[model samples]
Target: MGETNDVTALVAEVEEQERELVLTRFTHDDAWQLGCLLVELAVERRLAVTVDVRKGPQQVFHAALEGTTPDNDSWVQRKVRVVERFGASSFLTGLRARAKGQDFNAQHQLPLQEFAAHGGAFPVRVAGVGIVGVVTVSGLPQAEDHALVVEALRIHAAGGA
Candidate 1:
């Protein structure tokens, strides 16, 4: 019962974040800035991670910090695929699946190799344009990865970055 309440609260929180983080517009420059902001935050915290920003199918920015490997990059790709396919944060998708007592892969029939429902990938939604891209980070625990991206997005949305 407590676990179910936790999941419910988490789902609500993530959904609120998705609703609140919508951008007015997302351009190439915006992608670059957001990506750099993610890098800066990770560096300041001494986090080992890979960050990626994409506009549709085009990747605009990517960075692999110290201690990250090619596997982190692969994780970025998989999480990005989840955000792109589901039009939501990967964390949210996974949480929703868990709330329903289902395996994300089995429920969606998406192969794990190409699509992951783990955290750290978020939709870059524009106010009038909907989801135009995704911003992803990998290397931390799934929840921490998601929180890092959310923190960056919150800063970016508030014009702090």
Candidate 2:
């Protein structure tokens, strides 16, 4: 029961985040700023992670902090695919799948190597345009990866650095 309630609350929080973090507009400059901010935050916290921001298939910004490997980049790609395919945060997609007692891979029929439902990728939704791209981080625990992206998004959306 406690686990269920926790999942319910987390789902609500993520949903609210999705609604509230909508950008007025997303440009190349915006992606750069957001990606740099994520790097700054990770650096301040000494987090060794890789950050990526993309507008559609074009990557606007990407950085891999020290201690991250090529595997992190692969994770970012997989998680980004999840956001692109599901139109939601990868974490949220996984949570919803788990809540429904469904296997994400079995339900979605997406290859595990190409699409990961793990946290860290978030849709870059514009106020009028909907999801134009994704911001993703890798190299941390799943929830931590998701939280890092969310924190960066919250700061970016609020015009804070």
Q: Which candidate is the best by TM-score?
A: 1
Clashes of each: 0, 0
Tens digit per residue, CA lDDT, model 2, 1-161: 88778888888888998998898888999999999999999999999999999998899999999999999999999999899888999999988887777878889898889999999999999988899989999999999999999998888888885
TM-score of 2: 0.96
Candidate 2 runs further than 4 Å off: none
Q: Report, for every candidate in turn, its global Cα lDDT versus the true structure.
A: 0.94, 0.92
lDDT of 1: 0.94
Best by lDDT: 1
Q: Where is the poorest 10-residue window by lDDT in model 2? A: 97-106
Write candidate 1's Cα lDDT for 18-137 as tens digits: 999998888899899999999999999999999999988899999999999999999999999898888899999999999988999999998999999999999999998899999999
